[model samples]
Target: MTIVDTALHDSLRVLKLSGMLHTLDARLVQAQAGELGHLEFLQVLCHDEITRRETMSMQRRLRRARFEQTTTLEEFDFHASPKLPAAQIR
Candidate 1:
């Protein structure tokens, strides 16, 4: 009975070691993946200002087109088409 108990304990120890090694490897891989993803996020941030500026410029053009001399209702068809939005009513 004592021998059987000792064998069972040894098997459990081996299993524990295997599980720990697997978990450690997984953690290291995850850390590497996280670092790569962080780099991508930084690249996105670097271009964000440019993206914002272009968007604002486009918006300004749209705003200008909206308020640029349209006294007639047919000419001022804002929100009715993708080409024009936020135009004056009549």
Candidate 2:
């Protein structure tokens, strides 16, 4: 990384943009390879930060919910219990 890149990363860290900082290297590579414009680069960085925050929030909510097991209906075998009311479950 160049001096400018190091300085920018330090500034991002100080500003508590952890999400952007974490993805900085990969995003930089993508920007260079894709020849992304300034606004496009900024958009990607902002999106990464937003996605990180949202994912973290959802994880926190899930932990608070304290589910015994993480399961989805798609993994369920409804046919195994023929008596189960599939329509009511839905």
Candidate 3:
């Protein structure tokens, strides 16, 4: 990374913009390749940060819920419990 890039990254880190920091390099590459305008580049960075934060929030919530395993109704073995009404589950 260049000196300017390093300085910018440090500033972002100090400001606690970790999501942006993580995606900065990739976004820069995309901007260069696509010739994105300044506003468009900023938009991409902000969008990535928002998405990263939302995904992190969901993972944290899931961890707090302490699920033994993830499963869907389709994966359930209805044959094992024929007496149970499968239609009600839907």
How do all the candidates rank in terms of lDDT, highest first? 3, 2, 1
Best by TM-score: 2
Task: Please report, as a residue range, the 10-residue window in candidate 2 with the lowest summed lDDT.
Answer: 69-78
Backbone-clash count (model 3): 0
In model 1, where do residues sit more than 4 Å from their true spots? 1-39, 67-90
lDDT of each: 0.53, 0.89, 0.90
The parts of candidate 2 lying over 4 Å away from their true place are 76-90
What residue pairs clash in candidate 3, if any at all? none
lDDT of 1 at 46: 37
Per-model TM-score on C-alpha atoms: 0.30, 0.73, 0.72
lDDT (10s digit) by residue, model 1, range 1-90:
368745654664575433323233344355468853655544543354456557778889878888756355665556666565454423
Q: Per-residue lDDT for 9 in model 3? A: 100
Model 3: per-residue Cα lDDT over 1-90, one tens digit each: 899999999998998788899999988998889877789999988888898889999999989999999768999888899998999986
Q: What's the C-alpha lDDT at position 17 in model 2? A: 86
